[model samples]
Target: MDYDGILNRKPFSTAKDEKKLMYGEWLTELTDYHRKHCHSYGQLLKHLMIPEHSHMGEEEIPMLPVGLFKDMDLISIPGNKVFKTMTSSGTKGQTVSRIYLDRDTANYQQRALANIGGDFWGEERLPLLVLDSPDVLKNRNLFSARGAGILGFSIFSSRICYGLDQDMNLDTERIQQFLDRYTGKRILIFGFTYIIWKYFYQALAKSVQKLDLSEGILIHGGGFKKLEDQSVSAHEFKERIREVSSIKEIHNYYGMAEQTGSIYMECPKGHLHASLYSDIITRRGKDFSVCSHGEKGIIQVLSPLALSYPGHSILTEDEGIILGEDDCPCGRLGKYFKVLGRIHQAEIRGCSDTYDG
Candidate 1:
């Protein structure tokens, strides 16, 4: 498909308020078309055969988790057009798989970043301080930290990386140098939680130079899986970052390689809002019963941008509660939800292994 032309069909350039209308209608129409085209989806729809009228009920979009990406013939593009494959970092079973991403995937990823992240970063060229390992991008492991941001998000900017230290540590010298060089501008500091905490938080605690919070955004996520093991609460992480940097607007986004087109942005109140491109619903308790607003359950996410893959509305392993609707005081609209935590013993056999969705 000529994705460039499809994306350029007047979606992003329109007025800001129209995004939800355009995105919602387009997603619904796209999924209706997508359900008929993709094989796995077609099979699922045929097997269970949800009524034609029950389309927007947040049904699980038939997606083979990253682990099964190896086992199935999941490619949707013509075989000759297949480009790069992005894998996940998780326990590698005998059957491991990589997500086949065509140029369209890159296009979708770039557009989504520009539309959403652009709202946060704005037009100013912020000197970036990437608090991550240099080697993370070099190798091609599924859990490869470095490649994730570069491929999924950071390519949207031109700023360079101030990676880990010479002793393979979180190099404060490099970050400091970048900060010193790029003073008087809002900085963009990106890293996974543990690394950012270990490096910057530890440094701040030790009386190192504090981050200028008045001028920046700290975009970090790699799940709280490993971070919580260190006894760091989400509040503490935010507080410490605030204390060290002094930035009030700290956004923590959540996404996956399975469906990289949409990112769930965290509002200041600590709830992640579903983007215009996707919507979510939760199942109450252990029963897969669709819960009402403010009820806790599993998050089923739906996005229509996947062509090379099928990740429509997927049942995630995380349990969360929908706090409210588009009435956020923070100016971010749409269905807002708080991720309570990951469901225990949720046997999701795949590379994308965060139950806390």
Candidate 2:
């Protein structure tokens, strides 16, 4: 199949049946590819007793636990071909998952992100306001999920401005300058949920000053766990942001470094919708059985973009449920769902909790 052709289609245009067939074929091929190149992944397939030449459905595809990346070098590409290595967010002394990418895979990730993001925010590039300090992206070759996300979404920006200083302090002057320059134009704001809540929103709430960002659209995710612990619900998060900035459009996405480009984005209806580049399944923890609609279980993310690593299908530790498919009120033609939270006792990981500033 022409992968580029598939990517060129509108992100949510494909129906579930067609996507299953196409993704099944491509993902099956990827499994064979990884099994041939990565000895560790090959051993895993053998150990699982999956036949080499047998074709499998999307649900039948074998999945590696997301944690395995933290403990093993799971690269399918040659060492010399590694374009960059991305690590999951981790605090001091905590192990982080490392994802290896070659040039081809990296390019695909960027293209996929473009296609998906365009569907949400439109194809026009807007000025981007990053909510984190610029220091996070200093290490170009090796960086955490926060840096990777900033770089990935930077593609949609006409120009970029960091909202925070090197010390992780919210640079109100810089942000005010950016808003003044882009006045009356629609702008894009990107950040982790916790950072925006703790640094951006709270800082503005305490100060007597308020900035008008009515034309700004904020996209945040990756730290709902911390917010949940603080008793901040999604409604409260958005309400607080509006109280300070009056920015009406707010979206929360769900994704991780393991499947960087295949993010599930939240629609206006407040459900995370899976795109053509990716799919989500909820599975029962005890026996790994597929869950019915509205049934909560572990999240199994499937993506064909992880060619440089055997990360195409991963059983994540997060819990969620499928709301419906091909019938979202948001008008997208794919599965839309909600993430309840991480599995109980699951280690704290992801960009939102890794902030030390």
Candidate 3:
């Protein structure tokens, strides 16, 4: 599928009424496609098949989280295109987002994000300092998220600052020295969440040491799971990022290696909203079914552009809510949802465990 084309073919966001129609049509198509190709999901369609039902239903497909990845390889592409494979960072033998692509598929993901990133920054391209390295851009076997998923999305620009440290440590000297040499440059510093919090935040905050960076933006996607033990709330984490970089905008987005082009970013209003290519609904939640604003529930992501994998209409483990379904005062249009936490095994959705999904 021309994944990027599917996303940018039309205007992404729409009025609430229009979005409903759009989502309905998308869900129908996704369900039909999954029913045809996904072997395990096909079994689900048969089991949940209803009499007189000629089309796919929104609630019929059996939702499987990362647990399923431990058992089998869920892929739709030919084996020859399997550029690389990855593993779930959870317990051993867990499910991971298996990524495969040719140059077009790879470039599609990058162009989509770059278009959006360019739209947000109001620039054709910004100098990006990747928290990882050019190794991620190499052809050798590495984690797909590192090699293709993250780095691939960043290929639209040529001004890329790379990390040379093998230990993944943010070399303060390397970064500052580069910034000092290349002043008055607009940069987009990208990194995993806790990776920045662990390595860069304190160092930057140590006296509010501002670099010569003229205009820099931060886009981090590495989930907070790595720092689950470090005790950092999303707000405090952003605050820390602001405290260190002093950048007005620091977007903590939520995305997976599976769904290549669809991702949700935290708006300036502090709510993470679904992108145009994706939709999120709360099926069940605490105290009641979280069906509206201020209601927290399990987040189910629906991405129409997920033609490469089975993440088309995935119900993730993250617990979230549809904060609002309209244009925010912040001016971002689309569905808004905040990720409260993840739903852990055997734990009730509202049991108040620290992290589950």
Candidate 4:
């Protein structure tokens, strides 16, 4: 679907009309491809009486309930061609979504991640400090979403250091060593939100000694429901981290294992933005109709990269408000929105939520 061509374009620079037209054509093609190859998805389409020659706008496209992934092994590719299998971090005793990818699709995912991440990290690799224990990465093939996140971003690492020791305690000496060795260099810090807060930030607050991370770019995501339960807002999260570590640049991304690699990244102005290859739609909870800017509703994410599976148009359990399109104060094109949080008990999913008991 000319994924490379789409990913290579400026992430935040496409015109609204042009990008919409492009996404409509490609997404419609993907709808047909999945309908032909994936039996379960085809049944879903047929049951809904969606015609074979349906010419629907991107907003009118059918959306699968993301929970379907947990209940079925939905893949468009043959078993032997399945390159990798990724599982979502569903709550205990609950089912996790399994996403299948062929080699080409896997490579496309990585390239898409690299392109979007490049917007923030720039062209060069930086010294990376991961906020979790090294043990999480021991299994090279199987991964919890947290582990996959570390490995994905590690592609931009010149050198990598794990911040927590094996016991899930902050490894002061190890982290200090990395900072001391790469003193004054611009480093990248990655971790799930709660881990960075409970293990990293809380540890720093308790310690008499402080380490300087002033020259670092801290990127974290997963879910913030746990934090919200504790009365911590994103603003408070960033402010607390700054107070303890002196790191001014903190970016929080919104992504899921169901739609890996096609993340919505938070910009300088605190809004999560869609890149060139993907888009987001906020739909009214009552009718599933598209919502206007500033109206809160369920989130339906659209990505061309999900064609390998039946996930091209997924109605996620998340709720958010579409702030604007193509005219952010941060100057990024496409939709910019704020995640209001999860809808009910949607299984504490995402990378950060993986560690919860």
Candidate 5:
């Protein structure tokens, strides 16, 4: 598939009315394309008995459990053409998903990020403040989810500073220096949710100093289980951060290494909305059928961006509800939903056992 034309367009530019038909055609083509090129994926589809030329709507498109990536090297591209392999941050002793990408796919991922990042941070690059230690990026080749996230968004800024010390403490002196140097300029801050809450916000909250970052934009994501375990809700997370840092513009996104560039960003109204690069469908736990708005179920993510691998359609282990469509109070023209955290006992499997026929 030629991604040049698709990547050139701004992210989330498609209207909701047009998406059904547009994505319907695109996803159908991609499914057949992957089936023909990926031998293992073809076998899996046969096992599921999805008939050839099935005319089901986008929601019925066959999806592999996201855990399949950890079990097998699922790729559609030739081995020689593969340019990069992205691994998920599985827990200790757990196997991780290895996502393969050719030159085109990798470039497309960057372009998608650029478009979406521009939408959130504006076109101009800002002084970037990373909440992790610098050592995370030193390896250059392998990446945990945290490391890849830092590197992926680094393209938007020339000046980068790590906000954490080697011991993972809040380096107040370093952050103060960054603020002083970029005074009156818009800043971009990136970090995982729990890390920001524990290391950055808590540390700063305990300090006597007040830092005003009201003009800055903070983009954070990753699993929120850690925070929930500590009794920290998203609302409280935002409130505490604002109380400490004075940073008002914050967006928490939902994304995975499996579908690198397709990020569902939380709008100002606090709903995560999908973009043109991807779409989300909630499935009932009982029958794997699509759920209605305001209904909670497993989240099935679909994206055309995973051309190098069979990650186009994936049944993730997260639960969520489709709150609304085309009518987000934020005025974004797509489906907006809420994540209710990961399914219990879902992470223990190197590969998820659940399957959608």
Candidate 6:
């Protein structure tokens, strides 16, 4: 299906009613497409008794549990057509989720991400300073979430520099050179949350050197389980980052490997804003019923970008609460929410914290 109509729309421009109509048609089509192409998914729909061509509201759509990808090869495309396989980060001996992407789906992901990032960072491509080592991308065929994140966001950068060495140590000299080269210019910095806190922020805190990134915008995601253990709140993370570098703007996004590009980015108001490409709904654990605004429940992420797999609507292990819709003080039009971390005792599978590399 052609996605130009939806992709062309401004990231957060569509209001709730219009977005519901637009996304409803596209997502319903995607549901039928996946049910026909993927045998396992077809059986799942059959078992759930959701008839073919059924037009259901966003919350009424069937959501495959996110963990299913860890146990099954849930690709809708033929094997030969697979362009890339993305794996979620996990500790040693833990099974990771595998997300298959065909060329078209992958392209859509890139385009969608570019559109969303453009809305926030502007159209100009700036110099990018990645917080991880370049070696993480050595295995191009299969990517961990961290690797894919770096590659995906690299589109916003005119020149890219790796701030960490091969051993995951902060390469201060390399970072300094990168800063010097882009002095007095706005640059982009990307990294996983825990990695930035442990390697970049803490490492810088130990040294007498203080780098200047007053003109930089930092985008970070991947769960905060580790930092939470250290009692590091989001506010603290931003304040500490300022102590290390003069970077002023920091955004904490929420996304998973299952649905990569259509991330929920945090607005200036500290709420995670869902873009036009995706939507968010919270469900009570006891019955999976939709939750009202300000009520915390399991987060169900809905996106139409996962054409290569049955991942369009997924019941994530994470918990969150819908703060508001179409009325954020930031003026973005869409549902804004706050992630309340993973469900109790859910496997610790955030990109940075789980990645042993």
Order of quality (TM-score) = 2, 6, 4, 5, 3, 1
On the 0 to 100 scale, the lDDT of residue 22 in model 5 is 69
Model 5 residue 260 CA deviation (Å) reads: 0.5
All models: lDDT? 0.62, 0.90, 0.60, 0.87, 0.83, 0.90
List runs of model 6 lying over 4 Å from the truth.
Answer: none
- Tens-place lDDT per residue, model 5, 254-313, is 998899889888888999988888899999888999999999999999988888888889
- TM-score winner between 3 and 4, please give it: 4
- In model 2, the runs with Cα more than 4 Å from the true position are none
TM-scores of the models, in the order given:
0.80, 0.98, 0.82, 0.97, 0.93, 0.98
For residue 240, model 4's alpha carbon misses the true position, in angstroms, by 0.9
Clash number for model 2?
A: 0
> Model 1 shows how many backbone clashes?
10
lDDT of 3 by residue, 112-172 (tens): 6665665566546666777664554555554545454456546545576674466555566
Q: Give the lDDT of residue 222 in candidate 5.
A: 84
On lDDT, the stronger of 1 and 4 is 4
lDDT of 6 by residue, 1-357 (tens): 668877887999998998887667778888999999999999999999999998877777899998899999999999999999999878778898999999989988899999989989998999999998898899998999889999999999999999999898999899999999888999999999998998899999999999999999999998788898999999999999998998999999988889989998888889899999899989999999999999999999999889999899999998999999999999999999998888995877666635465
Residue pairs clashing, model 5: none
- Candidate 2 displacement at residue 149 in angstroms: 0.7
Q: Give lDDT tens digits, candidate 2, residues 254-296.
A: 9989999898899999999999999998999999999999999
- Deviation in Å, model 5, residue 41 alpha carbon: 0.6
Q: For model 1, how does the per-residue alpha-carbon lDDT over 202-290 read when each residue is reduced to its tens digit?
A: 76678756656466678876566666667777887888888877866677776666666577878677778776556677876566777
RMSD of each: 4.7, 1.0, 4.8, 1.4, 4.3, 1.1
Q: Candidate 5: misplaced stretches above 4 Å?
A: 53-56, 348-357
Worst 10 residues of 6 by lDDT: 348-357
Where does candidate 1 stray beyond 4 Å? 1-38, 50-73, 91-97, 139-146, 203-214, 245-248, 285-287, 347-357
Question: What TM-score would candidate 1 get against the native?
Answer: 0.80
lDDT of 4: 0.87
